[model samples]
Target: MTSVSQRPAPTPRQLTRTSDRLSFIYLERCTVHREANAITAQDAEGTTHIPSATIGTLLLGPGTRVTHQAMSVLGETGAAVCWVGEHGVRYYASGRALSRSSALMEAQARQWANPRQRLAVARDMYRMRFPDEDPTSLTRQELLGREGRRVKDCYRAQAARTGVPWRGRRYSPGDFTAGDTVNQSITAAAQCMYGIAHAVVTSLACSPALGFVHSGHELSFVLDIADLYKTEIGIPLAFDIAAESDEDPGPRTRRALRDRINEISLLNRCVDDIKRLLIPEATARAAAETDRDVVTLQTDGGHHIASGINYDDHENATW
Candidate 1:
């Protein structure tokens, strides 16, 4: 048997793609450890082995304990690990991304650095959420107003459809039970969406804090991406779950949302949407196709030269 240190780490191309993996696997009250490349979850009933490479995100809910070997395999396999609260309502921490390339990260930074470009991206985000409406000329205030109205309308519509009593949205952080069954479902779904979106964003190596629309928060970009599907997916599904039964709405919503995510191939769509929003279509395609682990030296006038060769004799060389 090979030692852990002697095991070869899989390259980016060797690992499973974010778009083709399991949406998420939520576990609680289990002791997670590793056996070869598979992570085993042991509980009172029995132990179950999960292929580490095929998992998009591992949501460790309350009472779940993970060993270092499990985490090592998960990181090696490029599977995101998220420590979430009960019913996956709160997100505490996350693991590294799968991507080895910085193409998308650079594009996000370039678009976020300029005020005009940032606003343009914000408008584009709004357009994505509401494809039928045009937002090219809307200011930030107007955009916020429109978003608020649309969300309110969605709530009313879902309520009407589900026949769940409609009251104003009420939610307080750290208090999952503060709201009614519908609101709890919505909150649960939103948190799950955040976890999923966060996994995809990080898998693509995009900065979660550098959001075009949301600002100041560490998960601003994650929030922005998750909101893109709220009205269409999260809200409606939350209502459906609540309408079914209020018992364990949080867990119920999470399971239902996972099914919906898989049914719609949401992970694939999210990866494509993120790339489209940050980079040109041609560049996005090129970046996705590039599997090289390359390094370069940046010189004056935005030029990049091949790395590893010293230019000590040249006076014009900056490095």
Candidate 2:
């Protein structure tokens, strides 16, 4: 076995890309420790090895204990670690991004900082969700109205297709068991989607609070990203799981959704979609600079200068 000190931290290129990683892995009643480049989960059964670099997010459910070395390896591999409730019902905390660059975050901020641009991105998101409909001329109220109607339609359509009974969405906060089978599954699926989105958002080094459609919350951007797949993936899958059986809908939906997400390569598409929404005009350039570590100092008139250089001088400089 290789000693811990002998293993060098993996570089950005050496680590698995977020788009190619597992959406999120939930572990409970296990002790997580590091062994070389992989994490070992020790439970009553035995020890299972998981490649740390391939994890987009690690959700530590109840009764999960993690060692410092495990965290170190996870951090080096740029995996987001989230402390979540059972079956990821409640989210408590998250780890850092995999990226060293802030270009995407800058692009997101630039689009969000302007009212017209923000509205345009919001409209674009609406368009992505409903490609057949045009939302370019709709006001925020109209967009919200349309979104509500469309989601309701999706619920009804999925119910009809699955032959499941639907009485609208009835979710009682803090009580997962309060809702019917479909509702419980929907909530579970949504939570899992949130986990996946949060991992992607953080991995891309984008601010989770800056959002085009949703606002005023730390995870507003996460919610916005997750909703992009609700009607298409989460809702339909939830209804399908509910149709199959009502037993343990939360865990069942999570497992099924994980499989579905991987099947559709949702992470890759999600990364591309977010880039298109926030920085459509600069996707190529953004992709090229995603892994760069260069930093620059801001100058007047939208200019950037080298960070290590001293700008103060007796001679007049235009900088």
Best by TM-score: 1
List model 2 lDDT by residue over 1-319, tens digit each. 8767567876777778899999989899999999877999999999999999999889999999999899988998999999998667899998879988898999999999999999999999999999999998999999999999999999999989999999989988778899999999999999999999999999989999999999999999999999999999999999999999989999999899989999999999999988888778765665778777788888789888888866666247785
Which 10-residue span in candidate 1 carries the lowest summed lDDT? 282-291
lDDT of 1 by residue, 98-185 (tens): 9978878888999999999999999998999999999999999999999999999999999999899989899988899999999999
What are the clashing pairs of model 1?
none
lDDT of 2 at 312: 67
User: How many residue-pair clashes does candidate 2 contain?
Assistant: 0
Candidate 1 regions with alpha-carbon error over 4 angstroms: 281-285, 289-291, 313-319
Model 1 residue 51 CA deviation (Å) reads 0.5
Question: Which regions of candidate 2 deviate over 4 angstroms?
Answer: 1-8, 310-315
Residue 303, model 1: lDDT of 85
Candidate 2, run of 10 with poorest lDDT = 310-319
